[model samples]
Target: MRIRPTSARGGLPPAAASAESPAALSGPDGRRLPASPRRRRPDLAALAVLLILGGTAATITLMLNGSARVSAIRITRQVTAGQPLSRAGMEEVRIAGTGIDYLPWSQHASYAQRLALVTLLPGTLLTTQMTATASEGITPGKARVGLALKPGQSPAELRAGQRVQIISLPRQDPGDRTTTVLAQSALVDAVSDPGTHGPPRLVNVIVDAALSPRIAAYASNGQIVLAYLPAAH
Candidate 1:
């Protein structure tokens, strides 16, 4: 019998079969594709843009969740030391909430930092207005004076008749290096807040006539720091 070619015999030859398969039809670069299959090219720019937008949204969300802003508060009526900052005493004078605008500037510390400086306890009622009035005499004594207490100060620790000491710290004098006693432990006799009615009562105390004049002079020139102390025996 004569040997016949496979294609002639209704079967493709080995070479013909190999050519029809996908591997044989591919290009030298390997990227070449047959008509039956295709590869898609991704848009790099579009993917990058999406990533940036997502990051921005996440940052904004974090800032919003971490910080909050509050409106400036005022004495709607009056407040006292040893008193709480009650809702009735203050109203959110302005509509404000925490956000980017509310954030403190870089020059100043955060709102939390300033808040730490607050010595007043919560719920402290404003006892008296700090004043710079003339002293009655010379010896150390307590006088009813005025104070401009900042908003959100606590006066709760204060009692009506509690004894308190007032002392002024010494500061550096540009002229001399010596530190002089600004004020020593002075006594506060009483405290009173009239509320919306009238002026709060000034702190009063008994002191020598000589010290009275000095107290008056100090109030006139420097700030008066009030301190609460234990009751006398």
Candidate 2:
């Protein structure tokens, strides 16, 4: 007997036979699979440009907000009614969203020589409503008078623009022991601090011109006392 080699079914080697068959790369439905698509890398330059634009927009928005603020005037120290406005008593501050009602630092000169219309506390925002001219202090038929009051004669909490009554206490004479009211509804114009040597405080009051004589006599004789009145509404 003679030995012979067996031939493949398609007359090709097994490896080459599998390679040429369509079923090797086909799906279960016998459709040929498509080639995989290539992935694309990100554009770094475009991304950097977008980031810079976003940051610039944010910065512009912040700058716009900051520019909306204005420099306004504020009181640095306590100011009494009738006291003259001075630069030392005021300071400039940056305020936002204040509208147009406040006094700005640029307009300080217009109000510097003016007087305060009421008691202004520290840190108060200066406004046109809080100031007035010196001529406003002396109204028609009113005269300002000064009185030197001892410690117990005047109210400890006395301030400018306060309403008070000028009272005349009884004298040392045994024949007359009557207390009289010299003037009523007197407006306090100004008050000075007590002296270091224990002297009496000086208070200036605006009263009716007709009552000036009586108030002067009583004040000079040290028989006058100040009675605090309720604030006018």
**Each prediction's TM-score versus the true structure:** 0.26, 0.45
lDDT tens string, model 1, 151-218?
12214445333334554434346664443333343333344554433543345543445555655655
lDDT of each: 0.41, 0.81
RMSD of 1: 17.8
For candidate 2, the 10 contiguous residues with the lowest summed lDDT are 3-12
Candidate 2: residue 71 Cα off by (Å): 0.8
TM-score of 1: 0.26
